[model samples]
Target: MACVGESNGLTFWVAEQKDYEDVMSISVNIYGGNDYLPHRYSDWMTEPDRVVILGRKDSKLVALESGFVVDEGRTLLVEGLRVCASERGRGVAGEIQRFADQYMQQLYPTLRTKRQTMSDYHSSESTKSLAKFTELGRRAILSFTGDGKSFNGFISHLKNKLNSTTGLDKAVSVQQMVPLEDAHHLKNILLDPELPKRVQLPGGVIIQDWQPFQPIKGNLEILARRNLTWLVNKLEKPNFLSFYTPPYPIAFDGGSLRFNIDMFGTDLDSAKRAFVSHFEKVMEKGLLTGKIMIHVFLDQSLWKEMKEFCAGETGLKLWREYWEQVIMERDVRGGAEGKRESNM
Candidate 1:
């Protein structure tokens, strides 16, 4: 409701519900009303924890940015940003960003990490502007389809990429799954008695006595009372699988899930074995109706181990082209940390 500044008589103001129509119009002009910009401004502005801002001149909306704080208020993820075509290069985007930065400082002084993501098809100008605010953290390449494929197909695709002597050397292998059920498949896998309840290492080292985690019910009751906020909370902590001595997690975005494994102790090989075992156990469950997209984080260190494990005639052999999306990320935090190379 407060005016942040002006650009050539264009007044940038903190957005209110009245600006929703203008917001949707700008989004349609920019993203063609595609799934990319699917939500209306009210969808964000009405959220209790979100920050929405708009820039306008003479009652005409010029630019917009929407974001939310996550990671216990340490990180702010900018979800969407748009500028009217007529206002391009007029410094409207920069002005709005400055306003956002000030707002964040005032609201959450402890905020440290500011992150954002851009899809492969984003305009070059959009990409450049995003890079200006936050450094590239990680790139995720993903594939989506309705065709049903076994979970093993996901592993096989990565194996093929690894086997490629010339390509996919820098990608971190992972999968994003959208199950037909409520993704209870993961919860079932964890509780299945037939599966090994331990991290079985390469040398038979076992981290045993697995137990299913039930998130603390402190906020569950409150969250249940507030549905939308609860969903947002759940999406924010997608990787929260279970509470263990050493916590490992999975990210659930609506119907989809993202799994990532990283070794902490010096026993890297043992960690890798345990991780692979878990991967196989989940994949063994298989999918019922929908397709799961596989994503690679181009710089994951585990690719070497995976390649080594899947070598030779006894190893799992796979071919490429089963996946559809490839991501490349560059680290601009602390000022460009070398260049990122990818075969995506």
Candidate 2:
């Protein structure tokens, strides 16, 4: 492991297999113990394309950071970074950020962007604000708008919608995304062996099996590359949906699955059908029955119908909210600034 200098007598170095335990052991103190690491943590830990670094004060590991090369070497994504409670005020994070800058400089000389996302904030509390602050000079893409309903009487209320067709003539294909080895559904979409599952970022950094239903915009790859997409489907027209379960199960109760939907036209009916179908499948698999949610911006044309359908539909609820706004910032090619120390 390469040593990345020191701050306040704390030494940071590139993480190796032996450092895994030390890194995993470092969690926010607010919780006493880390609940669970995100799925990406496991993926990056094992993936050859990613890098994991750790900081130590003598024999005790105190800070950690994981990043991956994207778009070839033009961008370095600091996927996960954390400093233990004891080292928070010591500038250990700052030292590692500087080291990352130097480390990438030698190998990826043309590195243009170093990006991260709010989605990576698994155990931290300042996730929302951290994301909002990171948009300063970087391009932000509207990820999703989320809405959810309680499972108090979901099963009973879902019968009518399941039996009656809205004459909408819409069909949606949903599959639960699971690890390749643990996957059981024969109808899995990611199982297709022939298609190009991974997308190549700008710098020739290829994201293994990082396939999306369609090519994501260049700037949006930061969000796409980190999370694995399992179930994906095209809506009736001008709409899309993709379901992602981070590398690990998260949240309380059995954890929740996250899905993103793009509603660009008047296909709210189809969207609803697709959502219910997906929800039913998730329930059938017993993936989650607690509270499921989605992110979407309703089109004005379908607002009335959606409002009525949601009000009348017993199983589903519509929440008018934007998960996040994608704000585009000027590309800062010169080593971007380090993310401020946040509890997120």
Candidate 3:
């Protein structure tokens, strides 16, 4: 492992596989067990584009952060940031982030932007009033909890409702967007000429499974690694689209799967149909089992309508009310004057 630098009495090291256990140990209770580090740390270590940074306070592991180069190395995504519980209230979080920004600049001189995403709760508490960051946009997250059996039952009910829909609704087309198969198609749709006027995307970025990706060939290569389900309304004139990031187990209730359905369009009817279609795709693969936490992310305008439809029309109760994920970015190519401490 390579040592990066020291700051504010904290020493930095390029985290390796050996540091996995310690990272998990310190982050056990983080996010109330919904932490993604434990699940992605192993892969992060092996990914050529990712660098996990460990911060030590007086020789003890006290914090961890990762910077992954994406958007063709023009953007460095800051993720898996967590400071050990014992180190809370101190400036360790900010210091480590500041140090990280500097270190990443040295490692990747081509990086022009630094980006991070946070829960609405955290974003509200952050000092965004400063000129260091730009608020890209936010997606509303509707949550629900159920076991595999319950989810199966819900899907079955949804099929019946869908079957009863009019012929016009049945004609609604949904297609899967794969990397090699649909790379150009995906790029054109995401970076379409009409997107700016429609403003379908927030800041022209695709935040999938909590990772904000730009619509570029390099970014598509990064995304192609995941087992994602992409559904669009049409190949010619697409308006609504959705992608379901396959479920991964979270440390909630012994262990439960976290499934995310990201809907990009504001069409209430299409969003609802795509929601069921994506769930059906998962069910077809027999991936649902045990306890599962479902999170539906969509445009803020469609949150209330989608929530009502899921509960009243689909019979799924809301696990929690109204959570939003805030996506933010800052120019690092000489625009940011000083240190940028991400509160994500």
TM-score preference between candidates 1 and 3, better one: 3
Residue 289, candidate 3: how far off, in angstroms? 0.3
In candidate 2, which residue ranges exceed 4 Å CA deviation?
A: 2-4, 29-40, 119-238, 251-267, 289-332, 335-344
Tens-place lDDT per residue, model 1, 191-276, is: 33322313212111111111011122222232222221000002222221211111111122233332323221222243233333
- Quote each prediction's TM-score: 0.45, 0.55, 0.89
The TM-score, computed over Cα atoms with residue i paired to residue i, of candidate 3 is 0.89
Model 2, 98-202: lDDT tens digits are: 566566566666766655543322315544335433342111112221224453255334434434543322243223222222233312322233222221111
| Prediction 1 TM-score vs. true | 0.45
Off by over 4 Å in 1: 4-9, 32-40, 123-344
Worst 10-residue lDDT window, candidate 3: 172-181
lDDT of 3 by residue, 1-344 (tens): 66779988999999999988889888887765677777887889899788888999887999998999998878999999889989987878888888888888998999989999888777655664234688898889888877787776786565555555533354444332322237667667666767533437777778888899876667767777876777776766567777888889899778988888887878776777788787777888888888888889888999997776666443466787898888889887654355233324
Worst 10 residues of 2 by lDDT: 199-208
Where does candidate 3 clash, by residue pair? Answer: none
Candidates ranked by lDDT: 3, 2, 1
